[model samples]
Target chain A: MDTRERLISSTRELLWERGYTGTSPKAIQERADVGQGSMYHHFRGKSDLALAAISRSAREMRDSADAVFTDTGTVVDRITAYLRRDRDALKGCPVGRLTQDPDVMADPELRRPVEETFAWLTDRLAGLLADGRTNGELDPRLDPEATATALVAVLQGGYVLARAAGSADVHARAVHGALGLLTGDARRSPSGQENR
Target chain B: MDTRERLISSTRELLWERGYTGTSPKAIQERADVGQGSMYHHFRGKSDLALAAISRSAREMRDSADAVFTDTGTVVDRITAYLRRDRDALKGCPVGRLTQDPDVMADPELRRPVEETFAWLTDRLAGLLADGRTNGELDPRLDPEATATALVAVLQGGYVLARAAGSADVHARAVHGALGLLTGDARRSPSGQENR
Candidate 1:
């Protein structure tokens, strides 16, 4: 990667791993294998680089989610595909995790990507649920906005439960648990790996 | 307050406001009005003091939650009360916020209180829902464990959504959204602030 790409990529990883307050310019320079001169040449400072990184992370998150969202399948199947998609349960959601960083939330410039990403996520999920409600598969009266809010919260909150336990099973439990509720069917969503 | 009490209180406040890694020993000493020697005399170091602070926070969290859980009300009413209880929505959940601190999650000692607290919470909530199922107030076939998981996620995830948007409304939305699903009555839970 070039100096700019290296810096942005490194900043994205650092932000995911350590958050904005914990990540430092020195660490970024070290991780990116670039020096102060090159970093400054490409960006104004730490916050500037972070905006690029945060925006990149948000887009990456949404794009990955959108793939499953827009893919051909029953609405339940697509939503399930999105929730059950492989993720680093222990590491948590890169974009969703940013909400915990005081530095990020304290600055609107830094917070925009995070905010927009969720706005898009809720809207996208709401749209999908609305489609599901229109079909006979789900209860016709299911509130799309409320249900979508619950689904998004399940994923983010699942990360919290997983991290707190230092185990990934709780994360899966939360996901399948949500799938069960949304499906309005009590059958356990196949763990896909019950042995684990 | 005594030096020990002051130190614990200050650490809890800092943990709630800034998370584990963002808080420093010097900051703790300054906030607690205790010197480094006094700090060490009472505790080993940052990690030790943090354990005390985390445990205290967990106990306090449980005490407050237990009041609602054990209160006289229908199961849905109690759970709704727990979710809608006045909270520092933007500041986020004190115990739930710890899950986001990588430093807290990395150390088993530091992570235990958070894990135990959530474990207790999920179990506590499941019990309440199971009671509802028995009383025929809620759907008899509702999966208590899975439903409980979703409810807890809504609260933790609600905080994430609200913080990302820099507004408490989304948090309320997530809460009432879950309540509607849990109640299975499908009426919008009043935000109580329709005026806003």
Candidate 2:
């Protein structure tokens, strides 16, 4: 890749693996295999490079979600696809994970990508749900905005659960649970008992 | 508080605010107002102190959640209470946020409290939902395990969204959405129309 592309991509991976505090400019330089002079030539500072990386990651996250959001399928199918998509549960959601970093959250410039990405997801999901309800695919009683928001939350929250549990099954279970709710199978337990 | 107590509490705060990699022994010593010898007398190192602090924090999290789970109310009311409980959205959940820290997730000992905390929450919420289903307060078809998992996911995910948006409102909205689905209010949009 080119110098700027290499730097941005390296920054994204470093940020994902180590977060803003743990990720250093020197580390970025080393990872990208670009010298200090090249890094400065590409960006003003660590924060500037971080902003570029975060913005790119956020864009990628939205694009990936949008693929499912606009895919040709029933609303439930689309939502399920979005939720059940394969992921690196242990690593967590790249954009969603950034919200946990104090450095990223402290900077408006750094935080904007993360912010806009979620806003876009919530809005996109909301629109799809509205269409589903209008077409009688979803329960007429469903609140698109709320349910959409909940679905997005489920995916993000599932990562937290999976990471904490050190297993992807927990994350999958969480996703299945959310999909059940959206698909109107809310009353059926995976094990065939209500409480048990 | 005693020296040990002060040390534990300070470590907990640092872990919450700075995470494992970001928090240092010196920082903890300063925060707790204890000298090197005192810190060593209380605990072996940062990890040891963090374990004590994380365990304590996990217990407190469960206690706070239990208050809502057992409060006098209908099942939906209890669930809503659990979701609506006051919180510091920007800071995120003490245990849930740790999932984002590579150092914490890498160490099994350090990860135990976080894992147990989420596991306990899922089990507790599932039990409550099963009771709700049995009591005829909820739709009989709702899967307790899945629904419970969904609720927990929403809370964790809500924190992510809220932190990303730089506002608690998004988190609150996500909760309301989850509650709406649980309460069978899913069909209604906020303005009584779709796409508005």
Candidate 3:
């Protein structure tokens, strides 16, 4: 790969592994196998390189989500597919993890990709829910905007819980619960009793 | 406060504000106004003092959550109270945030409090939902453990989204969505339609 590409890829990996604050320019230079002169020639500094990397991560995140959202199936099925998709639970979401870094959140440029990724996810999910409602696949009373927001939160927060306990099972269980709720199976327990 | 107390308190604040990797022993000393010798006298080093601080934060997290959980109300009401409780949304959850720190999660000693905090929360919420089911206040088909896990995730994840967007409104919206689903308000769209 080219020096610029190598630098961006290295920065992305470091950002995911060490976060923005913990990652250093020297580390990026070493990882990319590019000297300081080359690194500076490609980008102004760490923040500039980080912004490029973050934007790339943001686009990739959306593209992957879109693959599921646009796949053939009912809206609920699509949402389920997205939630159940394979992931590196311990590593957490590349875009979502940036929110936890004080430096990333402190910079408007750095924070924008993270912000837009979520906004896009929410909007995309909301659209699917609206389609479901129109087709009588979802409850007519369901508020698309609110429910969409919640679903996104579930995926993002599942990482937090799973990481804390050092267990992937926690993440799976949380997703299972959210899916049950969305699919209406969670309306009643297995004992066959109805909710009032 | 005594030297030890000041040290722990300072460590807690720094951990919350700058996270584990970003925080330094020197910074902790400066913040607590304690000498290096006094700091070392109280604890082995940064990790030891951080453990104490993390444990304290974990306890405070539980105590605050318990206040709402144990309050006089129906199962749903209590859940709502917990979700709606006022918070500094952008700052994120103390224990939940630690899950993002590589150093903290790398060491089991440092990770215990964080793990225990989430475990306790999931259990407590599960207990409440089971009670609701028994009292016929909730749907009989609802899986308490799963639903409780989702609820905790929503709160944890809500902070993540909010911090990303730099707005408390996103967090509130996510909570509203989760509550609507739990309360059965999200079963349909606002036009008064029903799901198939």
Alpha-carbon error at A171 in model 3, in Å?
A: 1.1
Can you write out model 1's per-residue Cα lDDT over A43-161, one digit (the tens) per residue? 99999999999999999888988989999988989998888888888888889888999999999999999999999999999999889878876777678887888789988998898
RMSD of candidate 2 to the truth, in angstroms, is 3.9
Per residue, candidate 2 scores C-alpha lDDT tens digits across A1-196 of 9999999999999999999999999999999999999999989999999999998998888888888888898887888778777788777888998888998898988998889999899999999989988898887888777788888899899889988988877777877777776776865444422111
Write down the lDDT of every candidate, Cα atoms only: 0.86, 0.85, 0.88
lDDT of 2: 0.85
Reference-based TM-score, model 1: 0.96
> Model 2, residue B57: what's the lDDT?
93
Put the candidates in lDDT order, highest first: 3, 1, 2
lDDT of 3 at B192: 17
Candidate 3, after superposition: displacement of residue A108 in Å?
0.4
Model 2 lDDT, residue B189, Cα: 42
lDDT of 2 by residue, B1-196 (tens): 9999999999989989988889999999999999999899879888899899999999999999998888898888888777877788777888898889998889999898899999899999999988988999887887888788878999999999988988877777788788777777754443321111
Model 2, residue A136: distance off in Å is 0.9
Write model 1 residue lDDT over B1-196, tens digit each, in one string.
9999999999999999899989999999999999999999999999999999999999999999999998998888898889888887888889999988888888988999999999999999989988988999877667888788778888899889989988888888887667766776545655583222
TM-score on B-chain, cand. 3 = 0.93
